[model samples]
Target: MDDTGLLVIVDAANVVGSVPDGWWRDRRGAAERLRDRLAAEGVPGHPGPVEIVLVTEGAARGVESVPGVLLDPAQGSGDDRMVDLVAEAGVFFFFFFFSDRELRRRVTSLGADVTGPRAVRPAGGAWAPRRDG
Candidate 1:
């Protein structure tokens, strides 16, 4: 087990893109919105206390960190960064990753638990809820 508590690293683009929304027009905005929600509600299924890291890249780059969520803005490939994070944490550590197929194998090989966007976003919702005016 990790000397530190659980780590939850979210793939900002993956989660944002997983749900169709006006995010295409404002990628950073969507990422920020997601960050806020994660900071507030957190991703479900965590067995105990945990820390959250939101990895931002490509269109969602430059999103800043909030109180509970640490923003990891990838310099290039977000997948590479996510891999690096898990690698840094020894195998005993428990991590929950929010991503899809491409990096699952690699992440699993490193011994980190992986999950999909559905764990965070609501099921059957085509679009992320827009902020109220």
Candidate 2:
């Protein structure tokens, strides 16, 4: 399959929250790290220069979109935005999220393939913020 034809819509908050990295402290930092890693890795099974749309909300709101990654900040709920993305995706596009049961149901109902946050990264690492003494 043509990987470039694929579109990855990610639930930034859910993905970031998947790991217990103290993301609650510096959500922007965590989201930024996720974005950089995604830019570097381009998702797990997907190929490149892949397309990634990351949806952010709450503390991680206002994350800017860069080349290769589209940072979508939800006006209210990230889950709702994800649903809208799935509803609007083309035939070849797919959806990626962490663990929102309702979201999974919604996206799948739209006939879109879905995967976990691991699709972005293995899970772990300095997802947390570092504080100096």
Candidate 3:
């Protein structure tokens, strides 16, 4: 979308919720941790550069955007906001990180490539670049 690389929109709530590492105790901290992870690791299967938009809502709001990641705080429903982003982007190629089936379907219907939260962070709660030969 920005001519840099794929536009990766991350569902913070879904991604964070994907793991049960006591994140529910600190929602904002969890989102920030995810943001920092993105800033450091980036979208793992995607080799090229990318523009990452981390969408946050509820207690996760007010999270600041880092260098490689931009924060999008949703006023109401985070799912709705993500849908609006895909619709507004038109036919641009996108890589979306989401675990929500309905949200995945909605974005995919708009021609987005949807993947699970593990795409950003594995189920083990760690993110290491895939080394494929």
State every prediction's TM-score relative to the real structure. Answer: 0.85, 0.86, 0.88
Q: What local lDDT does model 3 show for residue 62?
A: 87
What are the candidates' C-alpha RMSDs?
2.5, 2.7, 6.1
What pairs collide in candidate 2?
A: none
Q: Please give, for residues 1-116, the per-residue lDDT of candidate 1 as tens digits.
A: 35657788888888888876768888888898889988888767664677888999987888899998999999989999999988886645555556567689888888888777
The local lDDT score (0 to 100) that residue 75 gets in candidate 1 is: 95
- Give me the runs in candidate 2 sitting further than 4 Å from their true place: 1-4, 123-133
Among all candidates shown, the one with the greatest lDDT: 3
Clashing pairs in 3: none
Return the clash pairs for model 1, or none: none
Instruction: Report lDDT (Cα) of residue 54, candidate 1.
Output: 91
Ten-residue stretch with the least lDDT total in model 3 = 123-132
lDDT of 2 at 116: 79
Backbone collision count in every prediction? Answer: 0, 0, 0
**lDDT at position 128, candidate 3:** 34
Q: Whole-model lDDT, candidate 1?
A: 0.79
Give the true-structure RMSD of model 2: 2.7
